[model samples]
Target: MERFIEEELAIAKSVDLCAVAEYLGYTIRRVGKYYTIKEMDSIRIYSRSHWFRWSRQYEKGENGGSQIDFMRVFAGMEVKEAVFWLLDFAGYRRIEEPENRIVLKNQVVDKQEEKKTFILPVAAGSNTYLISYLNQERAISKVIIDYFIKKELIYEARGYHNIVFKGNDKAGITRFASMRGVFDKEGRAFKCDVAGNDKRYGFNDVNENSDVLVVFESAIDLMSYMDICADYESNKLALGMLSDAPLETFLTEHPQIVTLRFCLDNDEPGRKAAVELMEKYYQNGYEVEDCPPPVGYKDYNEWLKATKLLQRVPEEKAVMKSAHGMAK
Candidate 1:
């Protein structure tokens, strides 16, 4: 039994000792006590109580010189019986040598080491950066994020982090993707990661108490328009379909919302979605209106920049195509 315990302890250094202990139906700390990290280290006794000593008389070497003499004393088992029990715990078997009289031992080995965990790559310009097809992280700062926040087009969560400008230390930033929207003095949706959803998009504001709803395909466009009409209040509510799915869900849920202002992106997909929505919902007792871009700009962000409706980006810099869903 002592021999088997030593073998198991050796295997545990390479594997998970805690797991092995659990498999053997013993606590990890209790099992670990049998093995010393360094050879020649004396084993530490678990406890020394007068009552326990009086109950059983344990001579150290009686149990084959094992440190578990205390266990034998407590269990009221003879040295041979205790050894048998320990061997049974380790699933070992004893065999007699052939001709003369030698003893042999056998034990089963059934364990495999666990694998390591996977790690993701860092973004561009990072020393450890690698490429990924999906740049969802970049979508946060695209004109859409600001538009959503400014226009109140979506239900901004209370205590949500604010976007930070380069020069301002006061502005708090929660969105890790805001760097993608970094543009020149112009408000154009750049090639950064602009294609994605916001939490508040496609949500209704109950406290506003309005029957008329304003819907937009993307968050930025909705927000740009919100700044354009800050004075208008009441009866009008904003709806941002984070994507095509939410747009469909919104239309299905609010079939009775009569007025839907479609302020989608000026691109082909956006225009197609708007036309499809108009055909489907407008005929079903709904009033649909298209808010086309003012021209020379691909989206509301560009128009807003052109009109100086929001903060000006650098004029010399280029808007990231990846941020604006224009990247391949």
Candidate 2:
């Protein structure tokens, strides 16, 4: 048990206690009370609350603390237990003294420096970087592009440089896309590059006064839905959560939207965010609808691509509806 405390403390310090708690499905408070044994160095039995207090107290940088002081006060372990815990957590057989271990604490700092170069935040807002890669002539060859165009999922923009979709074509719609590239603060082009999670773009076209507004998980899915409703004319115009900040800003500054249909991502993050968004906006009269993708697919884009039924959508509205119903 003492060994467990040391190992757990090492992990807790390496990551945050909150993250560990989330992953382990156990609380720090409960773990402290159940697993702690005796401390070898301090001969003190530290309580859970006191350990947390010590963590907060010595948080920034403080030295000259004994090994027992750290384990008993900070880790909530007894002295005999702290020794074994440290040994087990550090993967060492034993420790003759506690103060020597203090000098080795800088290792985590080095690891932090290493991680800094690997991870980067995803870019938000407009992505015009794909412009250079756009081959208008070859775009027709891309099956996805052709599918949307044929179904009016996207309108042909002769001068926009790349294919652009309009949000005004439908009502109560949600949309999505796996767009790549980066954008500027003013919601305009910044650079052109290959697609990556490095950057992203999002937008919204829902009216606040509307009784129903649909939100899609990705821009591609939104476009697919738009193409599906191209003939209907009165169908919903979907927005993506990538557009959430913008939509919230718009709603806050102007009219408050009411009904909302959230076509959330089937993944964990999307589902969690959907719940949070629903909680945040539901009281404001914004009703959310869940448009889950078909079984075995995470979203509608995949559904459309896998099924290859977009080829059947004729340019005419009535014909498209008939085809869509039949395909479904």
Model number with the top lDDT = 2
Q: How does each model score on lDDT?
A: 0.38, 0.41
TM-score of every model? 0.34, 0.35
In model 2, state the lDDT of residue 223. Answer: 47
The per-residue C-alpha lDDT of model 1 at residue 76 equals 64
Sum up the clashes in candidate 2. Answer: 32
- Report the Cα lDDT for candidate 1: 0.38
Please list the residue runs of candidate 1 whose C-alpha ends up more than 4 Å from where it truly belongs after superposition.
1-208, 231-243, 251-256, 309-328
For model 2, residues 71-148, the per-residue Cα lDDT tens digits are 564457776675555333322233245544556544555343232231222322222322322222112124445444
The C-alpha RMSD in Å for every predicted model, in order, reads 25.6, 22.3
lDDT of 2 at 282: 77
Candidate 1 lDDT score at position 83: 54
Instruction: State residue 192's C-alpha deviation in candidate 1, in Å.
Output: 11
Candidate 2 deviant stretches above 4 angstroms: 1-201, 206-209, 229-243, 253-256, 309-328
